[model samples]
Target: MAKTVLITGTSSGIGLAAAVGAARAGWHAVATMRDTGRADALLEAAREAGVADRVQVKRLDVTDAASVATCVSEVVAEHGHLDAIVNNAGAGFVGTIEQHGMEQVRSVMEVNFFGVVELTRVALPHLRASGGRVITVTSIGGVVGQPFNESYCAAKFAVEGFMESLAPVAASTGVQVAVVEPGAVTSEFVNNVRLDVPAMLAQAGPYAPALRGYVDHALKSFGSDNAQTSEQAAAPVVDALTADRMPFRIQTSDWARDFVAVKLTDLDGSAVQTEMTGWLG
Candidate 1:
């Protein structure tokens, strides 16, 4: 029998690509999103790839505890067993701590950090039963903080620390855990942040010039040719699902690998701070 893998945030970007890729690889892909109404793109892509039969759509709001529990329970009950879970559902927030309110910061943590924790907590029992793995799509920001992305980076950093600490413990129980960090990828994720540059700069007050500088830098970075496509970034996720040995940390592209390396080797953390300082002009 083919194995099953459940993935969150399948409406678009890396999540959509990974869900389709997993189905093509012969795993029953439970492609989930907060709103199932947006699954058309995923289903169409899967159909074009000839993996529609292997891809199933489900509703999963990662930020909701009950939603997490119900989705995992229903998957196991219907599929008999779940071999893997890819926690790719996430949102992005772009602002300095002074610019955004505490509620906004907490909202970021709710989706990016707490959501991953809740889903993993709910899935661990079934994963242990099947000796399966947990794959989370964190970001390079998780390793190295970026300018104007305080809340986003903080949430991702929490996820990296959580998964890093959980890996060995999960292994002791016959389950594996890994975090996939991707640099800037061409995806709806950026657009979904809904950054109104002019309005934000106007409201930034003391932080306006720095905010403007950071926005310019970010636009150039995302528009650069070095940016990975969603599909390219999702490839590592599918690989981790089937690999004989998945590392505790996985970078999706060479760019991502080199980017994160700066932090790993920065003994005093000066290198990363200096590099990020450039973003603020």
Candidate 2:
């Protein structure tokens, strides 16, 4: 019997790649997204990899409480147990503090922070029963806040804190916890980002020049030759799932590892502020 892993946000990008990758790696992947209607690409990729029979596409809207509970229940019911779960369903928001209304912040939090908590909470029982693993897809921003990515980064940071805190307690039950943080990956995530550079610049007021400079630098870095592809980003998630022993934090690349290490090793923390803020005009 193959191990079963349920992953969220598989409509495309890393989620899609992880599903197919896990299937090829010999896990029965329950690839899920808010809309299973968009599963064509994932299914096709699974077919191409000759793992179609091992992959099952399901609908799982992480933000919906009932939906999260139901999806976890269904996976357990179908497989009699779940071996792992990858929390990849998330959205991004780009704006400064003044530009983001409270509602906007809450909306991003609902999906990124609260959604991870919801699914992980519901799946913990089954995971404990099976001594399963939990892998969350976070971002480098989660380690360090960015200029205009206040909301998205906040959400990631909150979830990172939650996971780190839960890891100890979860270990007592024989459940492993890990978070895979990736830097800029070539994915539809960029296309879906709620970015409004002009609008933000207009409202940037005294912060305009600094905001614009940071945005420009960030965008340039994202398009550089160093950006990881979705497949590359998914590699560490597969590692966490299949490795004999998993680490608490796994960065997808050296860039991500170094980027996050600064935060972890920054004692006073003011050094990081000075460095990252220096990117602004």
Candidate 3:
């Protein structure tokens, strides 16, 4: 019997690659996106990889509780059971802390942190039934700090902490939890970030140079073709699902491995919180 793996954010990038990769690897790949109609590229990729028949596209907005519940239930109803889940549906928010109001921070966290948590909460019973794997597609920023991405980094950091806390609980039930930390992968995530440039920020102040430099570097690095492709990042994520052995933390690129190693190798919650004080700014 073929295993079934459901993944989110399959409109494009690593999520789409992972969807097709799972199908090619002989799993029933349930590729989900915020809007099913936006999955043309995912469909094409699956077709080109000769995995279209094994792949299904569904609509899911992970932040919406009703949508999350209905989607997971529907997948289980259609497939009989869900063997694995990849929480890859997330976006970026780039702005200074002062520029981002509580609403902006909450908006980012709703999608990046709470969205994954709630969806997994609803899907846990199905996954637990099969001793399935749960993969959270995080970024290097999840482990380390970057200047201009306070909101995005905070959300990822929250995800890391949540997954860490949930891992032991899931282990008791035979469900394995792992995180994929990709570094600067070439994706639309950079261009699509919600940048809330406050009125004060538009006038240029003392912190303007630092903020501009951080944003410029992030945009240039993340948007460049020279960066690792989303397909490359999906390799380790797929490994996290199918491999006989899994690590709690799987870094995708060399930069990610280095960054996560330095940031997360020794620090626990207290240490991380202390270190991240200056970063949340």
Candidate 4:
């Protein structure tokens, strides 16, 4: 009678680690990704952790409503109940407002914001039935916007607001909600962005200098020793899934906690602006 938890984007990074972590904690982890072809690493990790039997791989593309519905339905039908869901599927975008097309901006929103809403919408009834919880892996950028990441930050901002607003309402129905914010983690998330520096720099009209500076700063930060490991970041997520009292907001590491605190305490917004300005060199 182990509880079930469905997690999206488990091909690598935090989602991969969270899936294995949940299985280790005795929850049946439904590890899902947009493409099952990329599941070898997750499967290997599960086997190494001795939790392979508890981790099930499934296909779930958050951007597709049908896929979301089918995945949730299958999990509930097979497990008889779904005790929790981890919305960890997301994409990274880098560029200023005018440099990118509207389609690009919309695409970012569709995956990062709307996708979470769609999956959560379809899973709420079952979550209520099982008194389940919702755990979303957002970024520190969601709280404090960064330069050259206007679109990505906007999408994450939207998610933070949506979840913050839905938390109280969900609690009334015996379902808990929480958002896990990770500053920077060593993972494939950055690689997945697929940035072509030379081409991008050549095309940068007025924003090239800023983009260059931001890219340099970002590369250093991601490669720095301060960045958390995927397992370290996913630890808080599993805690949220199983803790006795889950908070509405959870930071995966001390660095993330400190970074987010700037926004929470900023009264005039000058503090966050001042900090981000440095990223542009």
Candidate 5:
């Protein structure tokens, strides 16, 4: 039987790539985006990849509980069983902590963190029945905080913490939970981030030139000048699902690998803390 995998946020980026990758690997891919009306490109990509027959596009809005329930139900009904779900829907929000209101931060978390939690909660029963896996896309920023992106980092951290807690419980149930932390990958992510700050707090201001420099440096450091595209970054994630041995976490890029290695191997925590201070500033 072809394994059935449902993925969220497939309108573009890693989600779309993962869906196509799964289909190419002989799995049934139920791909979803916030609005199916805008998914012509995703469909076209699937067709170009020669996996259109195995890809099913659906409407899904992770922040909406009703939408999550309806989409999951529809996928399960169509596929009979869901072998995996990749929670790949999220965006970045950039602004100083004081300039960006808590409301804006909450909105970020609603979609990036709480939304995935809700979806996983609703999909648990079906997943447990089929002994499936839950894979979430986090970022290096989640493990190490950064300036001007507190909300985005917070949401990813929340996701990391949530999945870490769930992993132990799922171990006993034969269900697996893991996270993919990618450094940068070429996608629409940068163009999509919301910048909520007053003109007075503009990054380009003379008074805040130092702050502006730091922010620019971090953004550039996200991925290589010639970083992997969404399709390339999807390889490790797809590997995680089909691998003979499951890993609790997978970092998709070389930068991500080095960052996570330093994060995990830093027994003193001093080196990592030093690296984090620059971003926190």
Candidate 6:
């Protein structure tokens, strides 16, 4: 029997690419999104890739507990078992601390952090039963905090901590847990990020100049050649699921690895702060 993997946020970006990649690699791909109505791109891509027959588009709202349960249940019901799960259903927010209201901050955490927790929590049982894997599509932001990415980075940081804690415990039972961190991927992600620059600058008031400069720099960095295509970014997520040697953490690119390493190797924590200060200011 062929293996099966359910991936979230498959309407676009790395999630869509991963779903199609898995199908191409011989896994039954349950490609899910919040709105199945917007699955045209994934379906079209799958058809072009000759993997449409193995791709199934479903609706999954990871932030909703009932929706999460139903989606997992339905996938298992259709496939008899779930061999793996790709927690790729998340959005990004970019703003300074007070630039965002408490509700907006909570909203980011709900989707980016709690959604990963909810889906992974619900799917762990099925994964355990099948001796499966969990691959979360986190950003390099998870490994380090950046200016203007306060809330988004915070949420990803929470996810990194959560998954890291679970990895060792899960391994004893034959289940693998890992996170695939992508830096700037060339996808709808930049366009879709919840960033109201004007509003942020307005709310920023005192910090406006610095925040504006940082946003400009971040945009330029994102548009650079360093940005991985969605297909390229998804490769690590696919590997995290199918590779024989399961790694606890994997990044999509060397740039991402170096960007994250600054924080990880910052034992004194001053170097990263000094570097970020230069960029932010």
Off by over 4 Å in 5: 187-189, 194-207, 222-226, 267-269, 276-281
- Per-candidate TM equals 0.98, 0.96, 0.90, 0.98, 0.91, 0.97
Clashes of each: 0, 0, 0, 0, 0, 0
Per-residue error at 223 for model 3, in Å? Answer: 5.7
TM-score of 5: 0.91
Query: Candidate 2 vs candidate 4: which has greater TM-score?
Result: 4
Q: In model 1, where is the ten-residue run with the lowest total lDDT?
A: 184-193
How far residue 165's Cα lies from its native spot in candidate 6, in Å, is 0.5
For residues 143-250, write the lDDT of model 1, one tens digit per residue: 999988889999999999999999999999999999999998874445978889889988999999888888887888787876899999999999999899998899
CA-lDDT, candidates in order: 0.93, 0.90, 0.84, 0.93, 0.82, 0.89
Query: Model 5 over residues 1-281: C-alpha lDDT tens digits?
Result: 99998899888888888998989999999998988997888899989999899999988899989999999999888879998889999977776666658998999999999989998999888889988999998888778776666798999999999999999898788889989988777645456663333443564354365455555565565454646788878888789779765788888877688887887888888878787666534
By TM-score, how accurate is candidate 6? 0.97
Using TM-score as the measure, name the better of candidate 2 and candidate 3. 2
The TM-score between candidate 3 and the true structure equals 0.90
- List residue ranges in candidate 3 displaced over 4 A: 187-189, 194-204, 223-226, 265-281
Residue range 20-138, candidate 6, lDDT tens digits: 99998999999989999999999999999999999999888988999999999998898899999999998887777765678988999999999999999999999999999989888
Give the clash count for model 1: 0
Model 2 over residues 1-281: C-alpha lDDT tens digits?
Answer: 99999999998889999999999899999999999889999999999999999999988999899999999999999899999999999998877767668998999999999999999999999999999999999999889888778899999999999999999999999999999999988634447684677987898888889988887877777787657999999999998999988999999999888888888899999867987888795
Worst 10 residues of 4 by lDDT: 185-194
- Candidate achieving higher lDDT, 1 or 2: 1
| Backbone steric clashes in candidate 2, count | 0
Clashing pairs in 5: none
Superior candidate under lDDT, 1 versus 3: 1
